[model samples]
Target: MIFTVQIKVMPLKDLLDPQGKAVMGGLQNLGLNNVSDVRIGKHIDLQIEAENREAAIATAEEAAKKLLANPVMEVYEITVS
Candidate 1:
């Protein structure tokens, strides 16, 4: 079976996100001061071949851990469909 996987990769909370900060600054410059603690992350959508939903989830998790996300600085969450 083929499964669709959605992965969200984000910088760890304790880590500083300069890109997010820059964007936040831009937003503020645009008079959007209500936004705070902005964070930027990547969304990855991919399809994998697996026998079952569990297997698909496992594969997506492994892919996220091993390649898509930096375990030290970033964390990843996976959704399978």
Candidate 2:
């Protein structure tokens, strides 16, 4: 069966996100002060061939851990359907 997978990768909370911080600073400069702690993350959408949803999810998780994210500094989540 073919499944659709969505992956989200982001820096760990304890790590600094310079790009997100810069964007947040820009937002404040534009008078949008209500927003805080803005974080930047990556979204990946792909299709996979697997025997079942469980297998799809497992494959997606492996892909995320091995290539999509830096396990040491980033966290990843996967959704399969």
Candidate 3:
């Protein structure tokens, strides 16, 4: 069977996000002061061929841990469907 996987990778909450901060600064310059605490992350989508949903989720998590995320400074969330 084929399953669709969606992975989101982002810096840990305790870490600083320079890119996000830059965007927030830009937004503020544009007169959008209501925006606060902006964050930037990566979204990965792929199709995996697995025996079941559990296997698919496991494979996706492994992929995220090994390649998609830094594991030390970054965290990741995976969803299989």
**Candidates' C-alpha lDDT:** 0.95, 0.93, 0.93
Top model by lDDT, which number?
A: 1
Pairing residues by index, what is the TM-score of model 2? 0.94
Stretches of candidate 1 off by over 4 Å are none
Off by over 4 Å in 3: none
Per-residue CA lDDT of model 3 for 1-81, tens digit only, reads 999999999989999999999999999999999999999999999999999999999999889977889988889998875
By descending lDDT, how would the candidates be arranged?
A: 1, 2, 3
Candidate 1 clashes between residue pairs 3 or more apart in a chain or in different chains: none
lDDT preference between candidates 1 and 3, better one: 1
Worst 10 residues of 2 by lDDT: 72-81
Over 22-80, each residue of candidate 2 has an lDDT whose tens digit, in order, gives: 99999999999999999999999999999999999999988997799998889999987
In candidate 3, the residue pairs with backbone N, CA or C atoms under 3 Å apart (3 or more residues apart, or in different chains) clash, namely: none
Error of model 3, residue 55, in angstroms: 0.5
Candidate 1 has a TM-score of: 0.95
| Count of clashes, each model | 0, 0, 0
